[model samples]
Structure formats: structure tokens, C-alpha cells
Target: MLLSGHCLIVLERTVLAASPAEGCALLIGRRHAEALWVQRIWPCCNRWEPASERQRHFQLDPREQLLAQRWVRERGLQVLGAAHSHPSSPAVPSLSDRERSLGPTLLLIRSGLTDDPHPLRAWWLPEPAALPGPAPEALPLPLEAPLTGDLGE
Candidate 1:
């Protein structure tokens, strides 16, 4: 996926802002040829139920998602996928993440390790039931930061 440095910064800040809780956003952009260009990110509140599981789970506000869809449609962009932060884990997707994914799309996960040179990672996940076996491993996608060398871990 191709993302600008500014967008990366925005994603990091938005997700990290949640600190102990998880934060999420929708990736807004266009898909051209084989590349997905992330034009922007729409930050969303983590509305996971029970409140206590917010640290390990996230649910985009339905209202915000609808609004974001409208905004993207108006701008001729698509909601490429979703993004979220793992406040206490690595940039890799957790089992829960993979199990919950509706996929065949990109997923960007940011690690809590701020000091790490590359704290964010991207993955391409298949549909949950696309295969009959155990959940398939997510395919890693290289996150290219054109102006900033600060992504992927």
C-alpha cells in the first residue's frame, strides 16, 4: 500500500491517542492497477462492547462508518480497509483480529512500541470462510511511505 508520510503520522496519532484502549480508522483511497494508494484516514471511536475489552478489541461507530462512506463516495474514493492499534502488542495481527476480519482487504496495525523504527504493519486477509481449514495466515503488504521512512515492522 502507498501512504504519504502525513497520513502515517495522522494514523499513528489517532490510534495512539487511545493509549490503553484501542483506536481505529477507515482507509480512504483509490485502487489503481495493483497498488492501493491511501489518500487519507478517517479516525473512529472504538465502540467495543463491555468497555473492558477495549484494549484488545475495537468496533467502528456505525454512524461514523456511514458518514465516512458518504465522504469517500463524494470524493471518488473507496474505503480500502480498516486500521487499528495494538497498544501492548507487536504490529502483527492477533488471532482475534484474523478471526474477526471480514476481509479480502488490507488491514493496517500499529504497535505500541513508539521507539521502534517501524511501528506499523500491513496485511492482506482473505475472507473468514473463504477456506474450510483453520484461519489462514494474513499476507503481509509492504507499507511504502514515500516521504517518511516510518512504517512496517
Candidate 2:
């Protein structure tokens, strides 16, 4: 997965703003050859009902996800990935997270609110599981940033 620097900043700010609640967003970009490059990050609400606590769980509203799908199509881009914050924990997927996950979607998890870049991690979930499986292994998704000496955006 590739994310531009601008989009990453926006994602961090959005996630931090949500604070104790799990913030979620749709990663938007297109596929080129074999890689996904993220061009936009669309922030959405947590919308998980009856959350006695939101520090560890999040449910993306169906409506917002559908809208995001439509927007992706209209923009001629694909849903490059999904992202969420992990409020009080690490960026690793929880047991519940692994059980509910669908494969082949790149997932970005931000563990804490710090501006330092150490809290984020990415994973690739393989899809169409015949049964619920163990947590998908984590991936080393590098933040897609412009290299030095490149022209400004």
C-alpha cells in the first residue's frame, strides 16, 4: 500500500481528533500494475452502537461505506484500503478484529495519538475464508512519501 504524505497527515489529524473513540476512514486511490497507491483519505464516524467502551472496537456505518464505494467509482479510483485508530492499544489486530476481517483488503491501524510515526502499522488480509481463521500477519506498509529532490506537489 502506498499513501502520500499529505493523506497521512490528514489521517493522523482525523484519528487524533476522534481521541478515545476509534476513528475510521476509507483509503482511496487507484491500482497501477500490481500496487495500490493512496491518493485520498476520507474520514467517517465510528458509529458503533451501544459501545460501553470504544477504546478497542469500531463499526463503520454501512451507509458511509456504501457512500464511499459510490464515491470511489465516481472518482475512477478503487478503495485502496481501510484505516482505523486503536485508541488505547497497539496497532495490532485484536482477536475480534481477526474474526470479522475480510481478506485482501489492506488495513491501516494507528495505535496512539502521538504525532511520531511509530504507532502505525499495516496488514494485508486474505479474503474468502472457508472458516474464521487466526489473525492475519502484519505487513510492513511503508508510508508513501515524496522522495527528496522531487518537485513540490
Candidate 3:
């Protein structure tokens, strides 16, 4: 989940905008020798979780996931990871989050959005065992320069 500071800021804004509910998106980027470069943020609607359950859970619509996968491929990139808001909870994954974990892909959670630190955390579910060695985890993934200027995208 190596991304520019610009992407981080964007994620923060998105989560805050959707406060009280879970905001979800796809982190698409290319793989580099030193890191997974996040080149784009694909915001997707949380489709499966009913409106009432959104405060605590998120379900990336299968349709959106397919579309995002296609879009990432079109850009010559891959699904580097996923991002979602945790509402008022801490940035730690809940038991349900772990139970539903697919393992391997970088999963980012933004929690405490209504307070200081507004933590945006990352984790490596089970490590991509197919890789030659232990692939680097999402955290400690270097933050690159801002992807844009204040002027706008």
C-alpha cells in the first residue's frame, strides 16, 4: 500500500465525508522492487451491508469489484489493496473483519475519523505465500510525494 501523501489525504477526506458510515475503495497501483506504488483511488459503494449495518460493516459490491479490477488492468496495474472506514472504532480490525479476511492483499482501515490522529492503519492478512519471500507489509510502506498540487486534480 505504498502511496503518495496525496492519496492519504484523499482517503481521509473521503472517510470523513462518509462519516458514521463505512466508505470503501480500491487501491490500484503497480508493484515496484521496493514498494507497491498506489497510483489511483477507486471509491466504491458498500453494497451488501444494509444501510443500517453500515456503521460497523462494509461489503464491496461484487459488481464494483469487477469493474475496479478491469479498470486497474486497463491502467496496467493491479489491485494492490483495499481501503475502508471503521466509523468511530479504532483502526484495529475487529473479529468480524478477521473472520472475513481473504488474506494477502493489503487492507487499509481508517478509524477515529472524528478525533485526533484519525488513524489510517494497514495490515497484511496472511502474507502472500506464493511470493518468493515475505512480501513487505502495508505499513512502513513509504509515503511518496503528493500526487498533485493544491490547484486540483
Candidate 4:
């Protein structure tokens, strides 16, 4: 499905903010372009290095996960996708990343430092059930700064 205009804007901003050390979230809706509606979810990250892995990986901190759960409940929205920055590499997901993904989720990879030339890339990790169904679709979209102010306002 195509991203709504507003959602596109938010996704861009999230990509811009990613660093190798942290990750971000985006709440999405299945809707048409003109009537775009989306929310940006900035969840907390718990960083850890896997025994067999060299790159740092992160999971949602409890509080952040709670917040995400609540936000989804209150808004009746889906977790459309998530994003993270790779301090040293591109925002692409590693093998571990693929194993941890939950659904037809969006993965945004950012390269370099958080404040430096943060190029955003997008990928979709389909549910295991979807494997052998079709090839994953990767779309390259421009990352734009997010609109400011509370979502409720």
C-alpha cells in the first residue's frame, strides 16, 4: 500500500533522527492520500550486544512498549512499522533483525551518526506465513521533517 502524504512526512523525520544507537516508531493508518492521518511513536530503547553478534541491537523498553500499546489502543491504529539507526552502517536490518520482526513491518535504516548525512532506507519484513508468498518489497522514499505539535492538537 502507498503511504499517505502525512505519514510520508513523519517517516522522513524519523529516519533523519535515527542513530546507530537508537530506534524510532511510526503509527500508520490504511487510508488514502488526500485524507492522511498518522502518528509518530518515539519509544525507548534497551541496548544490548548479542554474544554471537557484533552490532548492537535494541528492544523496546518496558515503558515505551506500554506507551505504544496504550497509544495503539486509544487510537485504534496499527504499528505499521518501526525504524532504527545504524551508527556505522546503513539502516538495513541484520539477520537478527529479521528473526525479531513480528509482521509485515517497516524497517528504516539510517547510516552514520544521528546528526550526519542520515540517509533513510525502507524495507518490509513479511510475516513468516507470507514467506514463499512473494518477494519482499523495498521502497525508497524521501525522508522529511515531521510536523510539530501534539497529535491531539
Better of 2 and 3 by TM-score: 2
lDDT of each: 0.83, 0.78, 0.73, 0.56
**What is the clash tally of candidate 4?**
5
Model 3 segments more than 4 A misplaced: 113-118, 127-138, 146-153
TM-score of each: 0.85, 0.83, 0.80, 0.61
Cα lDDT tens digits, model 2, 41-153, are 88988887777566677877789889999998987988877788998778887766665667567788898845636598877767746336666667766667664563344
Highest lDDT: which candidate?
1
* Poorest lDDT segment (10 consecutive residues) of candidate 1: 131-140
Model 4 agreement with the true structure over 1-153: per-residue lDDT tens digits: 344346655555564454434555554543344332334545445444562232466665567666776777687775666666565665566666677778667666655545545366667787856554444555655434445665541
lDDT of 3 by residue, 1-153 (tens): 477877887777766577678888888888876467887788888774468888888888789889998887787888877788888787766666665657666778888545736377777666434434443343754677645557364
Alpha carbon lDDT of residue 41, candidate 4? 42
Weakest ten-residue segment in model 2 by summed lDDT: 144-153
Query: Residue by residue across 74-139, what tens digits does model 1's lDDT show?
Result: 989999999999998887777788778888778999988767555788887788775444544444
Error of 3 at 151 (Å): 4.5
Q: What residue pairs clash in candidate 1, if any at all?
A: none
TM-score of 1: 0.85
The runs of at least 3 residues in candidate 2 whose Cα sits more than 4 Å from the true structure, single-residue gaps closed, are 113-117, 128-134, 147-153
Cα lDDT for residue 67, model 3? 95
Candidate 3 global lDDT: 0.73
